[model samples]
Target: MSHLPAVTLNNGVAIPQVGFGVFQIPDAETQATVSTALEIGYRSIDTAAVYGNETGVGRAVAASGLLRDELFVTTKLWITDLGRTSARDALHASLDRLALDRVDLYLIHWPAPATDAYLEAWQGLEELYAEGLTRAIGVSNFLPEHLDRVVALGGTVPAVNQIELHPALRNRETAAAGAAHGVATEAWSPLAQGGALLAEAPVVAAARAHGVTPAQVVLRWHLQQGHIVIPKSATPSRIAANLDVFGFELTAAESAAIDALDRDGRIGPHPATFHG
Candidate 1:
């Protein structure tokens, strides 16, 4: 029973069980934070063009002296760059900023339902993927309708869907849909950005039983549910703690107990009406 198993992608690529997220790390601090993560056995690092820290992330990787193939790097094409030409250019720019020859994964940041350009944007991703510039491509914050259209129209079925999720907001439909379509479930904001749930009775009880922090309990739940989680923390201790979840395993009763915590509690914006 391996705790950290490799999740095979639709294209047969293997991603680590957990990765570090760089959602809000300031540009200047991104390097130090990512360097700390890498040094702590984090082989995968997730970034996006909107994050404004590709340069710092790239610098951290360069300084780490790790082989390029040993790392799993992901970056997204911003919503503003959804068109064909602009999206292609954005990929190149991200590669330049990260100083990587190619990204392991790329995603369309959002469907941007108002414009309905995700189809074309996804086409751009397919072109990039076929050219070997991107190992796999997917979407983030996409609804079922968006996924249906993308898959029906010859677009890639998305290797992963990084959505706003945590114990309090599980997005069951999306997860089920992902499984139905051979897409992996990826939970972003695994901590709900540090929500009150961490102190709630159920999580606290489970944490006390396991002798781990509530945050660790919640992250462990995500892993047990077969999700690829990217938990972010600016502090090195928190970052390290988020990764120290492998030693404990949650039982069926505990898993259901935490699943009961879901009360439609979504920390991020609703994807249905989100503008970007």
Candidate 2:
């Protein structure tokens, strides 16, 4: 089995540096695909209430026969569930679908500044954390200002801040802001939704130099920069290939070259304006 490295979060909980994501993965295909990933050595599985595949993820994990402690599962609360009571109820609903007693990490899916209740939602996460329903809690797609609000509201500092990150859309500012508060940055669209950054000249050059795929090169860049990355793939070969990045290293020049590819090209919805 491949030994994936782990990064300790602010709360002293360790998370696998590389995780498997199931975004937009059809519900019907989720079980088999996630089971294949587990068979390929992916211990961390990320899903969300919005994904509509939490039950599939639950089924795969249960069927994997891996010890509950051996796997790290994460899920998120949706926008509609954005207050203390509703957030707690939403978490219970998600847990029912996941069929797990407790998720390793539960995150607030979005700040939804328009609703202006993320702080209240965050307090609900705090209650979950205190109640031991989740080991750790964090937020996703939160900008610096949102984090600042958390700081002002006085709650547990988020252990992770998941955001859309890739070479072409390096969110250094948000990552740095999270880092300032000891929140580990986790990349959601780590491969730029798979293939856009893989074709970039710098990424291609690094891949050739490393004798690996461009996707591997980009994942290595994220790891080298100390960010947690989850690259999603339903294809068996590509799933295995994505985790094969541990064998090589990216040089400083090569890393910088890929960094230079940043053009503020964000491929996902902007957190500032995305209400859903």
Global lDDT scores for all candidate models = 0.89, 0.93
Q: lDDT tens string, model 2, 1-276?
A: 127899899999999999999999988899999999999999999999999999999999999999998999999999999999999999999999999999999999999998679999999999999999999999999999999899788779999999999888899899999989999999998988646778999999989998999999999999999999889998999999998888999999999999999989898899999998
* Candidate with maximal TM-score: 2
Worst 10 residues of 1 by lDDT: 1-10
User: Each model's TM-score, in the order given?
Assistant: 0.97, 0.98
Residue 169 local lDDT, model 1: 88
Q: Model 1, residue 135: displacement in angstroms?
A: 0.6
Model 2 C-alpha RMSD vs. true structure (Å) is 1.1
C-alpha displacement of 83 in model 2, angstroms? 0.4
Off by over 4 Å in 1: 1-4
The sequence of per-residue lDDT tens digits that candidate 1 reaches over residues 118-142 is: 7888888889999999999999998
